[model samples]
Target: MPDGGLDPVIHAPARLRVVATLAALGPGDELSFPKLQKLLDMTAGNLSTHLRKLEDAGYVHVTKTHEGRTPATYLRLTGAGRAAFEAYTTALTTLLRGTAS
Candidate 1:
């Protein structure tokens, strides 16, 4: 994004939902893949695709682990991501208010 513009990386609808959900978590908090999938009501593949994009953008951090015989994925928004989301919201509000007047 350039100068108060919305970030393309965080602007897509599905990705936005994913970011918004993760942003709700407290700092240092993380969510497991299955739990996030349930919260977003998204298919594993769908969520994975979006997650990959966010991860590539340096906006999200992903961790892979094993729980007994099972594999688990955990996700959290990074500091840059939180900052970007905050900027996005502020820009969106400004845009909306501009049209309202």
Candidate 2:
């Protein structure tokens, strides 16, 4: 067995946190921009930058909508995102356990 490789895209700290947060949500559940920002304790610009990277990787789906008079953004993990996150975790776990696959 060979060691599993880590995914650079999902390995970044900020992006990893974002993906992990989304993975914890229930299926079909999404976190609004404000909520996610507050939860992660990140500034809007920082979160947006990381999210853009994830979105470009097809790991997240971001939707914008108007809530009454205010604009709102929502983010959810796509199937691909979930699978990638799972793989990343598995690889990390294997590495920690000194195991190879």
TM-score of each: 0.92, 0.93
Q: Give candidate 2's TM-score.
A: 0.93
RMSD of each: 2.4, 2.3
Which window of ten consecutive residues has the lowest lDDT sum in model 2? 1-10
Question: What overall lDDT goes with each candidate model?
Answer: 0.92, 0.91
Candidate 1 per-residue lDDT over residues 1-101, each given as its tens digit: 56358898899999999999999999769999999999999999999999999999899999999999999999999999999899899888887778522
User: Candidate 2, after superposition: displacement of residue 85 in Å?
Assistant: 0.4
- How would you encode candidate 2's per-residue C-alpha lDDT over 1-91 as one tens digit per residue? 1335778888989999999999999766899989999999999999999999999999999999998999999999999999999889989
Q: What's the number of clashes in each of the models?
A: 0, 0
**Poorly placed runs, candidate 2 (over 4 Å):** 1-4
* Alpha-carbon RMSD, candidate 2: 2.3
Name the lDDT of candidate 1.
0.92
